[model samples]
Target: MLTLTSPVETAFHRLPAGVKLGAVALGSVLALQVTSLAGVGLLLAGLAAAYLSQGVVFARAAGRQISGLWPVVAVILVWHGWTGAWAAGAVVSGRMIFAIGLATLATMTTRLEAMLMLAERALQPLARLGINPKAIALAMALVIRFTPVLLDKAAQLVQAWRARSPRRAGARIVLPVALAALDDAEQVAEALRARGGL
Candidate 1:
């Protein structure tokens, strides 16, 4: 499983993990608040400019991550188009693009350890209500870590399916992807046990 964190260093990478995550969330909220498609498009363009400032390789990596989301974006646009809500489709897809782009940027800039620490700190206040913050934080961190890995796995599965079929294999790989995810979960569980159970 590959990490989503980009190798290209930038000023954003120097910021605190919690700060980056907060910025991502705030950006997403602002993006969603825009009812106009053009507004969301501008937001996306602004994000793209920021990404571009990080250099060509950084921009390309970000582009690939955003492009990987084509399937879901296509569905939203097509469904809205069929339902005679083209504006809604544009706004929805545009919001998704910006939100996903912002998240990808945060993950690319922040290290996994930093993210984990931030999560743990954020959850600590919940411990007063009998919640084990460490355990919850660890779980959240693992999910965040594996999300891109699973996406990469799905992409590989799609590529392999395409190699053997003339038609696009869309949802056909769902079962395999699920099974693979389960296998990953099992491995992570074993690792946690070996590490003395968080």
Candidate 2:
């Protein structure tokens, strides 16, 4: 599985995964309360400063991870523009950028093992309800790890489509991507079963 954790050591790398996760969750919730463009801008500025404090290389890596948000932001902007709600669109986009930035930062700084451990710990109480915390944690980690992989696969499909056709791939690639994801899942399941099944 591909890990998002950065190799460059930073202050956030020393912080507990749970702490970073909790902070991101809280910040995301608070970000939703911010409806004003000025407030969202200030929040984004603070987020950018945090990234900069991590040094140029780390900041660039973080920026690249969040760059995928541009497509979603464009969709949001287009819808809001059609409705003639420019300010609302700006505020919504800013808030989303801030939230995703914070999440990307946390993921880049925290190790997968550390996050899995934290999730297992947090879900310990659920074990009493016939739930398997380790399995749950593993599932969460797998989702996090595979999300980028899936995105990369989709991008590759798009590129391949463009190479063969003048038109966009559009929904044509959806089935192939879904098939690829299912194939990956089957392999993972087999591996887990070989290791005594989570």
Candidate 3:
């Protein structure tokens, strides 16, 4: 998962999830206008301050989550560098960092159930068009809830492979991970049926 809500008693955790989510959407829109390191740096600086207000550990967790896309970021930077478009690469990477960073912040601060309730309320207008917003809300909540679990499982599999093999895990753990995911899905399906289906 990109973010898991911290149990820390931060002020942001007390705010309405809808407000934070709206702000994140607006922030993402503004992030797109950033075309220079200075603009991105300003945003990052502000975010850093906010995170730091929560605590050093909260800030560190956020940083780790942000770094997960380093491989993709590296490719963009290297490709642009090779083509002599270093500035463009920086802008793109910076935009990505800002956009994802804000979204992750909102995620980390808001409880998953609160987010689901807010999303369901926000989607109510779609009900007029015959859409089942509750179902959508449930799906979104499930994704938010399980994404971190899935990532952890993947990491554990990789670690297990590393412990048993001299070489890197790489693609070797894919099959096992797939099977684990399938098992999770089956369990979810069974539980949902027992609950009378969603």
Candidate 1 local Cα displacement, residue 16, angstroms: 1.0
The model with the greatest lDDT is 2
The Cα RMSD in angstroms, rounded to one decimal, for candidate 3 relative to the true structure is: 2.5
Could you report the Cα RMSD, in angstroms, for every candidate shown? 3.3, 2.0, 2.5
In model 3, what is the error at residue 7, expressed in angstroms?
3.9
What tens digits encode model 1's per-residue C-alpha lDDT throughout 1-198? 246888688999999998899999898888878999779878988999999999999999888878988999899989999999999998999988888999999989988888888888888899899899889877877787788889889999999998999998888999999999999999989988998996
TM-score of 2: 0.88
Residue 19 accuracy (lDDT) in model 3:
87
Task: List candidate 2 segments past 4 Å from native.
Answer: 159-167
Model 2: per-residue Cα lDDT over 76-102, one tens digit each: 999999999988999999999999999
Q: Using Cα atoms with residue i matched to residue i, what is each candidate's TM-score against the true structure?
A: 0.80, 0.88, 0.85
- List, residue by residue over 1-198, the lDDT tens digit for candidate 3: 334777566888888998898898899899888888899889888888988888998888888878898998999999999999999998898888878888888888888788888889989999999999998998787776677788799999988888898899888888888888789879988999999986
* Residue 52 shift from truth in candidate 2, angstroms: 0.5
Q: Name the candidate, 2 or 3, with the larger TM-score value.
A: 2
Top candidate, metric TM-score: 2
- In order, candidate lDDTs are 0.88, 0.92, 0.85
State candidate 1's TM-score. Answer: 0.80
- Rank list by TM-score: 2, 3, 1
Q: lDDT (0-100) at residue 137 of candidate 2?
A: 92
